[model samples]
Target: MTRPAATAFPTPDDLFENAPCGYLVLSEDGTIRMVNGTFCRWLSCARAELVGKRIAARLSVSSRIAYETHFMPLLRLGGASHEISFDFLDAGGGAFPASVSALFCPAGEQESSIRLTVFPAVQRRRYERGLLEAREASEVARHSELETGKLREQFVAVLGHDLRNPLAAVSAGIRALSREATTERGARVLVLMEGSVQRMFGLIENILDFARARLGGGIVLTQCITDQLPAILSQVVDELRATNPDRVIDASFDLRTPVECDPSRIAQLVSNLLGNAISHGAADRPVRLSAVSTASGDLTVIVTNEGPTIPPDAMDRLFEPFVRGASSGYSEGLGLGLHIASEIAKAHDAVLDVTSEDSVTSFRLRLSAVRAS
Candidate 1:
């Protein structure tokens, strides 16, 4: 076998001069006594140029302050300090972040010195600044979105209010014409016009109510204990029947107890539910409305219709404003009827729920009763 060549190890001076990080030795007075090639290269200066200078002279203002106030005192007490952040200035007057660690050697007979190593921290600093900027941008976007929503709701409120005057004028003209004598054909035309006006009025009311509720006024109520709930509900059914003469509606009332609630609002809610049923329910089948008052002073009203079952995905968002049923072909209204009805139910402290199965859909409203004293 050939004799193995002698293993050549790196000399001490070679290791010190070619270290991966910046290295420096400083006197207790803070003058640089020695520096490695890596440190000189980092500052874009020669090692001889940096050896005699004070280390503070190479630091930025803020870093100099931190070094003198915090880094030096801690090293003197503990004899060692690790991971202190400082910004080092180059010969070109540019600055870069560094993580510095130092060990203090006390002088017994030799001169005391501090040995320091520096690691670059540019990437960490950049990452921290990016996180801060992203958080600020997110907050600004959230505030702008809220402001835009408020403006849109205000526009809806204004538009709804302005439309009422012209609608009232049209309704007045129709009524005036109805009072005069007319041929049978003219009478039928007048009736159709009246129905159209009523529908427009309902749509306007829904829009106004939606705006009011969204603007924080909520659904205002004038609650009273009344036995006229059955009559009020019956009138709602009659009005829907008048508008849809060809559709069949069956209504039953067994309200034997008075309940404390907003009568007009209740009528509006029932009208909305019945109208939805008439529009979306099967045209050949009869829509049913049942109002029952229990001896325990609770009131329940249910509206049922035979139709295609509501899809499972739509059940969660059924009461959200402007959400319409995906399967319903009739698209006459703004899809606010169910939403307004739910709001009315909340105002009365009642529960409004729905179920659909086996080609039938039902909406149930339950109210706790308050009998007249």
Candidate 2:
């Protein structure tokens, strides 16, 4: 045998009275029969004021209810609850946020003796305040970042418009000159001018929409039927096919329900997901899309491609700004599409999820159904 177990030393009752933390012993009727100096000072009440008083009588109504509903049971049942938090209001209307913990004990053989303990968490509470401040500062920085990005987009849009107006004029002038020249050289000039004008138009449209969001004018939402979705997607698909002759799009959607959505924003969300998939997913394979209504009045749409498995840890930060996963191209986009799409989804009370395994990756959009109007 190593050594005998040491007997637990017991402190005197007076030692408890001078405890560093607050302490009180209450009767079953909720009368404070004994307390320490720490509690009296912590509550900012005098001994005469706190003596024989009910805990609820001093606390605010909310605190009182919290005590009655939770604390009372915990104490009465001789249970322990830790780190319970609430606000206490003083007589002068000064509110103090506090974290408290309590344990109940029997004084003797009878359960009528209820001993309770409470302590102030000033340091922890101060840390919580610091966290709140940091969160607010982060929000301010995000807003500032968005504002700066919007200014850049707006500048680009304005410049594109100024340049395009002149290009359009020159294209028109070239067409008129081609009509007068009636030669092969004139035809080639007309073709080049028309191609340049079309390219400029597309770039300007994308930039203008991105800039409008910076001014707090987001994509407006509407309730639309599922029937209209196929045609809308077909239009985008046809446009993509014109440039990428090697790629094919497969679209499937359920016809059973309508959804609350902003059509253009929803389209943009899908287009980005699909574009990302096409850029990273296995080439020479079909990129698939499908939508269906759930029994819970939710609509779920999935875009899947047969390529890439994202790492476990990366999934958590995938939607975060500037964090790119294997599913994204090396020089694809600025990492804002998922962020913007996520905001759009929130505006519609929707959810977006990305999952990958082996070489198959899927992005899903889930939206609540809107009543047909």
Candidate 3:
């Protein structure tokens, strides 16, 4: 092996003033001999102010005590000390943390000199404190979310229980009045009452379902073998038509396969879509409902209405809970209808999609009819 050439190193003058850490040279009695730019800048003082002064005089009270009682004696006995932590007084009269390492050198039988490297630890201290605060804030947020969830569950339970009792009593009273009404005007009032009650019932059911989906796993479906999907959808349309006789709801169905699904959920899904269309669609145009079964064992339901097109930005969040359409031309309910319909579609393993263009909006639900094993 060839002997390596001597490597050139930076001169002491180059390294002393511009070292990464603060550098100092002191007399044997601990008076400063020379100070670097880094050391002087760290103390926010000029080199002249520190050169003839004792380094211990610039230390914080506690650090001075530690230096006088422990460090000075240790250096005298062992000729060196390493990694001693202390505090330095800054220009603002506040103390900042620092770590120091010092080495002693004897010069020709004369008094020894000391060389020290000082590392300012302000950033390290700030980082440690920041980490502690972040952990505490995370813990507080987690606790708050837990409490909020518990309160939501309790409110949902109480609301569903208390509101249903009064609603049932109102329904019973309406039925009694309907039986006694003998005039056409009274009969019309009873019809209006019936429509109002049905709408209220739908709203309450939506609230309960929304609560269950939020607090529990999701909407639960009771699937069974049934060939009544068209009938269920037709019934939903008829009910909505009854409530809004002026708006035309044209429905068409072609189903050739018996489906395995939750009939009530399917009906609810159509009901929600129909209600949305009736509320937002152009009043003068007919809302169309179509259901078809494909040869590949899939059932599809499509609801279309002519209305102002939904904005592209709004489409992404259309199915989010409590989000209402911006261009729907009307405000209604809690904006939970589409959200509940989406959850019902998920329970049936279906895809629900919406498209809007040229002042027409369509919602489609496609369900796989493959029997569950």
lDDT of each: 0.89, 0.68, 0.85
Could you tell me the TM-score of candidate 1? 0.77
TM-score of 2: 0.47
- TM-scores of all models? 0.77, 0.47, 0.72
- Alpha-carbon shift of residue 100 in model 2 (angstroms): 31
lDDT tens digits by residue: candidate 1, 44-150:
88777789899999899999999999999999999999999999888888997899999999997998999999888999889988999999999999899889978
Model 3 agreement with the true structure over 1-373: per-residue lDDT tens digits: 1212333785777677767799888998889998888777777887788889999888999999999999988888898899898888867778868889998897777777999999988888789789999999999999999889878866975697678889889989988988893799988887888888888888888888888877775798898877888878888888888889899999999877777778899898889998888888899999999988877658899999998888888899999988876544676677889999999998887899999999999999989876445
Pairs clashing within candidate 3: none
Please state the error at residue 194 of candidate 2 in Å: 10
Q: For candidate 1, what is the lDDT?
A: 0.89
Ranking by lDDT: 1, 3, 2
TM-score of 3: 0.72
Candidate 2 minimal-lDDT segment of 10 residues: 1-10
A best-first ranking of the candidates according to their TM-score comes to 1, 3, 2
Q: Which candidate is the best by lDDT?
A: 1
Q: What is the lDDT of candidate 2?
A: 0.68
Error of 1 at 98 (Å): 4.7
